[model samples]
Target: MNFRAEIDIMPLKELLDPQGKAVSSGLKKMNFTSVEDVRIGKHISIKLSANTKEEATTQVENACKKLLANPIMEGYKFELIAE
Candidate 1:
């Protein structure tokens, strides 16, 4: 079996995001004022061999915890689908 994973990792809401804030401010200056509370994150797409969706999810979660995200200041979520 094969699985595909889509992952999103972002900073915790309480944590300060200087880059996101900066981008938001910039957007306002550019007349895109409706944009607010903007936060930036990474999206990861992965393809792998797995016996089940659950296994794929577990593997992706472990990978996220180990290297994809900073658990202390960030949160991550993923979806696994059959490929």
Candidate 2:
């Protein structure tokens, strides 16, 4: 079976996101005052062969924990689809 994983990694709410905050501030200066509390994150897509959706999810989760996301300051979520 072939599977695809769509992953999103974001900074933990307790941690400050400098890039997002900067963007929000810039937007306000540009007259986009309604924009507030902005945060930035990363998206990752992976395609691989797996025996089942559960297996694929576990694989992707391990990848995220081991390499993709920093556990100390980040959180991650993912979805799996058949492809």
Candidate 3:
């Protein structure tokens, strides 16, 4: 069996996102005043072979904890779908 994994990585709440702030400012300058509190993040996708959704989820979680995210300064979430 195979699974499709979708991963999202974002900065911790306490971390200051200069780039995001800068972009937000730019948007306001462009007359997009409705936009507020902009933040940026990364998305990653992967395909894995597993016997069950539980196994695939575990694999993706482990990958996030070990290499995909900097647990101290960043947060990550993932979804697993059987393929």
Candidate 4:
């Protein structure tokens, strides 16, 4: 079976997001006053082959924990779709 994993990595909510803040400030300066806050994150897409959905889930989770996301400063979530 083939699976597509869609992952999102984001800074922990307790941490400050300077990039997001900067963008938000820029938007407000551009007259987008309605914007209150902004947070930036990464979206990752991975396609892989696995024998079962559980295997695919494990692979994606391991990828996130080991390489894709910084567990100390960032958190991640992913969804798997059959392909």
Candidate 1 vs candidate 2: which has greater lDDT?
Answer: 2
Instruction: Give stretches of model 4 more than 4 Å off.
Output: none
CA error at residue 56 for candidate 2, angstroms? 0.3
Per-residue lDDT tens digits for candidate 3, residues 1-83, read: 99999998999989999889999999999999999898888899999999888888888999999999999889998888777
Report lDDT (CA) for all predictions.
0.89, 0.94, 0.91, 0.97
Candidate 4 lDDT by residue in tens digits, 1-83: 99999999999999999999999999999999999999999999999999999999999999999999999999999999999
What range of 10 consecutive residues in model 3 has the weakest lDDT sum?
74-83
* lDDT of candidate 2 over 1-83, digit per residue (tens): 99989999999999999999999999999999898689999999999889988889889989999999999999999989899
Give the higher-lDDT candidate: 3 or 4.
Answer: 4
Worst 10 residues of 4 by lDDT: 57-66
Candidate order, TM-score descending: 4, 3, 2, 1
For each candidate in turn, the TM-score is 0.92, 0.93, 0.94, 0.96
Pairs that clash in candidate 1: none
| Candidate 1 C-alpha lDDT tens digits along 39-75 | 9988999899988777887899899999989999999
Error of 4 at 29 (Å): 1.0
Question: Which prediction has more favorable TM-score, 1 or 3?
Answer: 3
What is the lDDT for 58 in model 3?
A: 85
Clashes of each: 0, 0, 0, 0
Q: Between 2 and 3, whose TM-score is larger?
A: 3
